[model samples]
Target: MLTKEFDKPLQILDQDGQVVGPLPPNLAPDRLLEWYRMMWLTRFLSNKLVALQRQGRATTWIPSNGQEATAVGLATPLLEQDWLTASPREMGGYLQKGVSPAAVAYFCRGYPPPPELVGKDARCLPFTIVIGTQTLHSVGLAMAAKMRNENSVVVGTCGDGATSEGDFSEALNFAGVYHAPLVMVVVNNGWAISVPSHKQYAAKHLAMRGIGFGLPARLVDGNDILAVHAVMEEAVANARAGGGPTLVECVTHRQAAHSTSDDPTRYCPPENLALWETRDPLKRFRRFLYDGGYLDEKADKALTLEIEAYMNEEVQRAYDYPAPAPESFFDKVYAEPTPRLARQREEVRQETGAKR
Candidate 1:
């Protein structure tokens, strides 16, 4: 049986980005570069989305500003067939899992998700706006996968605040009892909205909750991409091997506000935020690449320009797309609309002067 590691958070990179612990044996320089690119892309996209939101092109968005390491690391190891149920802040994971920037942009604007995000073959569920609900969906998916004797593992990610929800507890109980092939990742970014972690739970570490459910658990340095990837890889492997669920608590900080609607300065102290800035995952990882000679100023500048150009084009396309038709709301809810819904649909059609 896999055991819980209740010690300090696992970390492979120091704040200086130098390897402070043993590196993963399988990680190569090229793979590290790829990981760096993904993290950079995720960060850039998140920043751009926030900018778009400010400019009224996008709706409220959860910025994954400081959590790129945790997002990309956890996602990089998953196979194409593996399923992911993620929160809004996990746009990094979504992008890493082959989700398109255009699709994400459209979704953020309250439009229908791009076709790429729909259907079973997408291998990723839409972002769960409701806290802790995705855990149940992940458990259900894992249970079904186990029933079919498939090797696929279902991963569910949520923030620290989600752990307090009843659905989270129930899902953990079900996953434990059935030994479902699920991995629950808690991105413990110290705040569940405006509430800090100290007030959210009494436990010293959230990973302890998983131990109570009879599953292996680990506390990981969410800023250390290598550590996050290493820990998740083991958890995924164990789940695929039929060892059951594991809960990984990624300890990081939400550098940005909870969403575009929130104001973190109202609750979070500036000093605390500044302290975390010193450990910014992107900055740390960039230093590592530079020190290793994998990235230089010229290459970094070129990559930044390339990604920015791509993002600008995609954002413009999303902005140019027509708004959702009024009729579309009444459609897709059912194969055949109910009597009341059918009447409402006609009312919308008449009100909007939309035909067919």
Candidate 2:
């Protein structure tokens, strides 16, 4: 029987969507339905983003198709005041923190989020494209919060590939030494772009790395939202209570090409691909909701269609936003441009022949 000991990767729901262990606190049927909707929205919107790339409307996008549960579960337990610092493929976290779908659409099209919608609106950080860098950023933020005696806890996430980065190691080391109020989550999808994880490390589970740094750690089923959410709640609570940083390794799979620019079929293992398809997080969660009488076919279809229609409208709105100017990159560097940046900005403007 499954137990709270969590000696193995925790799994609350099995392949058939049957509960195999205890549910998390306050997991009412309504909340479960809400969680399912978020997962669906993430996958549905993410698939449309992939299409945007194919149609040449977007430069490229990171697809989070098979990893919905980890993204959603990782963000669910976080308070409005807590921080969510993430690398890309975390659409669910953005939406969970009340990010506008239109803003996400705008960002995916290579534009900054309209400046008005950030700051007080959400504690979530802008998407970081450079792998593993967000880990350090979050750790630094948490250390600052600790110094100021604030209650915020920072949650940082990265792909399995980031574990090899010097930044990842340094961030973990710093957090451990300082006991920063941070939680680091590794969305271990078993492959780093074209490279399988076995080639990256000899350790069986990435969670063990945390133990090496004197932080609590757990390996959880990333597809099992119940398990993921519960584990994240404990980690977040631990950090908030001054217990220091905790590391969680969520084992999931990337269902699509790493990004619109890469091709997975060239190297992804066929047998493993077939296996993970059956473990699709959205399907599994939807089935759990159905079995528990929280959802019916008609209700599911209606909600999904509503979201689908809204997605198109929002994406179109994103496309309608004026394209970014060539020199706009220098605009946000500081409250006022540094003298050197002002000169460089002027040079770019002259080269582009952009009218003043």
Q: By TM-score, who's the top model here?
A: 1
Lowest lDDT block of 10, candidate 2: 1-10
In model 2, what is the error at residue 315, expressed in angstroms?
A: 1.8
Tens digits of per-residue lDDT for model 1 on 78-110?
998899999879888877787777778888788
After superposing candidate 1 on the true structure, give the runs of residues whose Cα lies further than 4 Å from its correct spot.
116-120, 352-356
- Cα-based lDDT for every prediction: 0.86, 0.86
| Model 2 ranges off by over 4 Å | 1-7, 117-120, 336-340, 354-356
Q: After superposition, how far is residue 39 of candidate 2 from its true place, in Å?
A: 0.8
Q: Mind sharing the TM-score for model 1?
A: 0.94
